[model samples]
Target: MAGPNIKHAAYHGPSIMKEIFFGISLSLMAGYLWKRHHWNIQRRTREFYGLLDRGEISVVVEDD
Candidate 1:
């Protein structure tokens, strides 16, 4: 019984590695998307106002 149990013991190394890789990939993707969206909004706002630089750190969007 001891020998059989040892033989069937679970190894979680591969699953843990896979989860770490997946988490990193997802975090990087989310960060990239967030940055891209922010840049796009800044670009559009600059074009609309003919601004030369992104001087302000934040912009208020009012409902119309």
Candidate 2:
């Protein structure tokens, strides 16, 4: 009886340029997200502080 030989598939990893491009793109995306998050946090904090300073913290109950 003769056994069949199987050839494994070869994998070509990402090129150096591809890796660099992906790294830069991912870094930019992360930075943008981080900056946006910080901006939103700061805006909310400022709003809260402004309301507090003006003594506008009140709860009004409304029936729908």
Candidate 3:
């Protein structure tokens, strides 16, 4: 019990718990957005394939 006086060391800024919560929330939101974007890409790809299969769109070859 022979430590120095440390009574005035309280941090008066954002709380650690709050910061952690916000960081976790932001990360989860980012992941959710990424998943949605991936799903969108997949859906578009499927649609494009369907169109091609049904002859709704065609591919043209060019000479080299």
Candidate 4:
């Protein structure tokens, strides 16, 4: 009983730690990508608005 419990604990300890590490790594990567995506969107929006402000582009509104 003692031997089996010790073996199980040893096996599960590293497994649990590996899972936690991967989870943290994935979360950090996802957060970084999300932040970059947000920045890119904001940059594009600013550029578009700047173009409109400069009369480089125009929008035509139509009546529904």
lDDT of each: 0.79, 0.90, 0.94, 0.88
User: What tens digits encode model 3's per-residue C-alpha lDDT throughout 1-64?
Assistant: 8889777877799989999999999999999999999999999999999999998887866579
Give the backbone clash total of model 4. Answer: 0
Misplaced by over 4 Å in model 2 are: 1-13, 58-64
- Per residue, candidate 1 scores C-alpha lDDT tens digits across 10-56 of 76566878889999999999999999999999999778666435544
Q: Write the per-residue lDDT of candidate 2 for residues 1-64, one digit (tens) a residue.
A: 8789888889888799999999999999999999999999999999988997887874556679
RMSD of each predicted structure: 9.2, 6.9, 7.4, 6.4
Query: Looking at model 3, how many pairs of residues clash?
Result: 0
> What is the TM-score (0 to 1) of candidate 3?
0.66
Q: Best lDDT goes to which candidate?
A: 3
Off by over 4 Å in 4: 1-14, 61-64
Q: Report the lDDT tens digits of candidate 4 across residue range 1-64.
A: 3454443334434577888999999999999999999999999999999999998888977589
Clashes of 1: 0
Better of 1 and 3 by TM-score: 3
TM-score between model 1 and native: 0.55
lDDT of 1 at 46: 71
